[model samples]
Target: MKAKNDAPLRSRQLIGYFVFSILLNGFGNGLTVAMNLGSALWTASAVNLAHALHLTLLTVLLAEGVAVVLFNALVLRRLEWRRIAGNFIFMIPFSFLVSWFAQLIGMTPLVALPLMWRVVLDLFGIVCTGVAVSIYQRLNVMLHPNDDLMQILRFHFLHGNAALAQPLSFVPPITLILICVLATRQAYALNIGTLFSLVAQGAIVGLADRVVFPQLKHRHLVV
Candidate 1:
């Protein structure tokens, strides 16, 4: 049997990995965003999109979720309202949590830390993001729009190669960021952390799949 089927992994199923992933993802992303040292590429893209459009992060995130859902349906050539509903379910509360966490952290002194320390914090946030993504993606139960897109590509298109699918799923954000830069002549949250995120997020998610939570595996999800 795969390690995913082991007794230990089964034990982990009782710990609510979904809930854990939500908090971890929210906190990691919020910290990086609030600090603005850099954040994951997609998050930065969303931030830039928000700035470009003069919208709240939550609004942009939710709107992006809807857009991706349609894109996903296009790719699959079918509209699965149940899957779309789940995407909304994931983004609505999760977006609120992300905003809340960023607001909370912005109020604290952590955002004003020295350059080197802030870099470290931002990098750590990236790592947390990778781990959080790994857990939830492997669980393959509930997922955000971008993540759902990743899963769609990984399984249906890429034949389960996450490293390939992960980066490919970033097209929307990359496009948005480009649009924002063209209009504003600058990008928000594009920095060292974002660079690292562009290169490392997929690999980190791949690594975390095996090391961070070896028991959890992609459950062969279908949308």
Candidate 2:
């Protein structure tokens, strides 16, 4: 039903949406830092390694990015250079927003607040992360290499069955979490935020589909 020439315009629109989603993801990351706890699974693993190896968090994150690219290339049996480039490009804005938001909207003022307040902040982060990820998934456009690999595995190997896709997608991050937990012997290697992110992924996506996406459509923010 779509015209052929619409492809280019649609592609550009998807790219724009993807960029916006990544920025929200970055804000979510900053909020996680503000919570003074471990972030989502992948980031928690990276943080664990950063502390143990005495390396900068960004350096370890870049290593993880490269590993993801290699894994995607292997699984898909093709080198998507655009995905490779996207990893680099997304990291730039992601890292910047994380740092900027951490300072601008940090939890510093809430140091004296109760645990419930911090929990509220973390929940907000979860919402941001959940909505951003949901939008990204719905767009069915370009993704970071790590996410692309997960989607590929979900679609190709799992036949797009969400039950299979969900558990299987956790493999990489869980592996990283275990490795860090065993290496560091930290009881909190996987903190509440990370665990919640994993468990609530489905709910979050559903919320976005039912609630957030409609708002975007009504506002003509995404097409």
Query: Which candidate has the top score in TM-score?
Result: 1
Task: Name the weakest run of 10 consecutive residues (lDDT summed) in model 2.
Answer: 214-223
| lDDT at residue 6 of model 1 (Cα atoms) | 23
Runs with alpha carbons beyond 4 Å of true place in candidate 2: 1-16, 103-107, 161-167, 187-189, 214-223
- Model 2, 160-188: lDDT tens digits are 44435544666887787677768878733
For 178-202, candidate 1 gives per-residue lDDT tens digits of 8899999987898899888888888
Which candidate achieves the best lDDT against the true structure?
1
How far off is residue 45 in model 2, in Å? Answer: 1.0
TM-score between candidate 2 and the true structure: 0.78
Lowest summed-lDDT stretch of 10 residues in model 1? 1-10
